[model samples]
Target: MRQSLLALLAKEPAHGYELKQALEAIFGSAYPSPNIGQIYVTLGRLEKDGHVRSVGVEQSNRPNKKVYYITAAGLETLQAWAEEPTEGPRVRDEFFMKLVLAPMTGLSDRMALINRQRRHYLSLMRELGELAERTDPGDRVALLLIEGAMLHLQADLDWLERCQEELP
Candidate 1:
């Protein structure tokens, strides 16, 4: 959620509700989106630390909201976070968990599962490539991240193929 907040705040100042909507848009329908309460909590934390500020009021017929603008300090912190190296992306793969139990099931089942993952990864690579093509050339960081994703997926696919070939 921190990542989502950081990315949205980087673009422009937004109210908590606006940030929630933007996050849903980027994530699409695959996962459950963050709640408005969560968004407000994050904004509160940022504000308390002086990383964000309540810039102005956004009046509406329905509900009036306070919009937040990221401070210069916030930008610096975000930039530093973006540039920092991590121990790879933090994610949980159900497929990897399934693979760990594959030997107990059967070699054929394991091979089939690996092939399915390979196909899925290949499809993801194609989608990422298409997205890259549509993105502006000036977005070097985005481009580099996309390329890195493709390479990572390719490596996984290759390993799956090798495993399939070696197994009975």
Candidate 2:
């Protein structure tokens, strides 16, 4: 959230509401929108950290608004963040932890665990598929995000099947 706001401020100075609107416009409804309070809190933190500077903008009939602009340090941070590669997928995840620990914990029902996770993944895939169908064809970004989720779910289901085979 901090870096996103910094990037937006780098483009131009904006108040918290404007930044929030920009984020929603970019991500669409695919992501849960950040609350106004969250944006303000982030801005406050950024100001304290010297990543952003805020100035009071007075209006005749409305309350004074604090407009934020990104600093040079913020731009450097944003640039570094843009260049950094994201971490790869985790090999030892929550599901794997449960699968390995179940026997020692005396549950000893790996198949049940795998089946339950598989069902959950399939349900998510179905929901995402429906969303994809409802999404406008011209909105390529949303479509791509939905398709990517579906693909990940499919991979998860396949991994569950492998777990079932190997554990049994």
Candidate 3:
């Protein structure tokens, strides 16, 4: 969460609401949605740690919002995080777990689930492609995110095809 918050601040100065929106847009329905509380907590931590600071306050009709901007130290932290070396490939695949466990179920049920997931992933990939194309050309970060999402979906599709061939 800290790394994610730092990266979001690096993109642009945003109020808590906008930051939450961006996170929801990126994560979709997979994870629990972030709330104002989560955003504020992250901001408070970042501010206390000197990675981010309150830039200004905006008075809205509803309430005043504190806007945050990333400091140079924050950017440096992000850079270091980005540069860190680690294990070759990290894999935490819920879908694969589902696939592995499907053999206990009826064949029709298993196939139906696979087909449904394939269609959903394909739809998501198409949406990601459209989003990448629609994003501002200068927004390379967003485009890269979309690209990664699309690639993952495509790989899933490939796996689904292979399963189709191997099964029945």
Greater-TM-score candidate between 1 and 3: 1
Window of ten residues with lowest summed lDDT in model 2: 86-95
- Please identify model 2 stretches exceeding 4 Å from their true place: none
Residue range 1-168, candidate 1, lDDT tens digits = 765686688798888888988877765543467888978898898888878888667567765678888888888888888899867754336666777677786663777788788878889988999988987787666677778878887777776777677765
Q: Could you give the candidate ranking by TM-score, starting with the highest?
A: 2, 1, 3
TM-score of 2: 0.93
Candidate 3, 53-157: lDDT as tens digits: 886675777666688999999999999998998554444377666666777764535577689888888788777877777777766656676777777677778
Measured over all alpha carbons after superposition, the RMSD of each candidate to the real structure, in angstroms, is 5.8, 1.5, 6.4
Put down candidate 2 lDDT per residue, 28-145, tens digits, no spaces: 8677888999999999999999999999999999999999999989899999999999786665388899998897798768877887887888888889988988988887778888
Estimate every model's Cα lDDT from 0 to 1: 0.77, 0.88, 0.79
**Candidate 3: segments with Cα more than 4 A from true spot:** 4-36, 43-83, 86-92, 166-168
lDDT of 1: 0.77
Residue 124, model 1: lDDT of 94
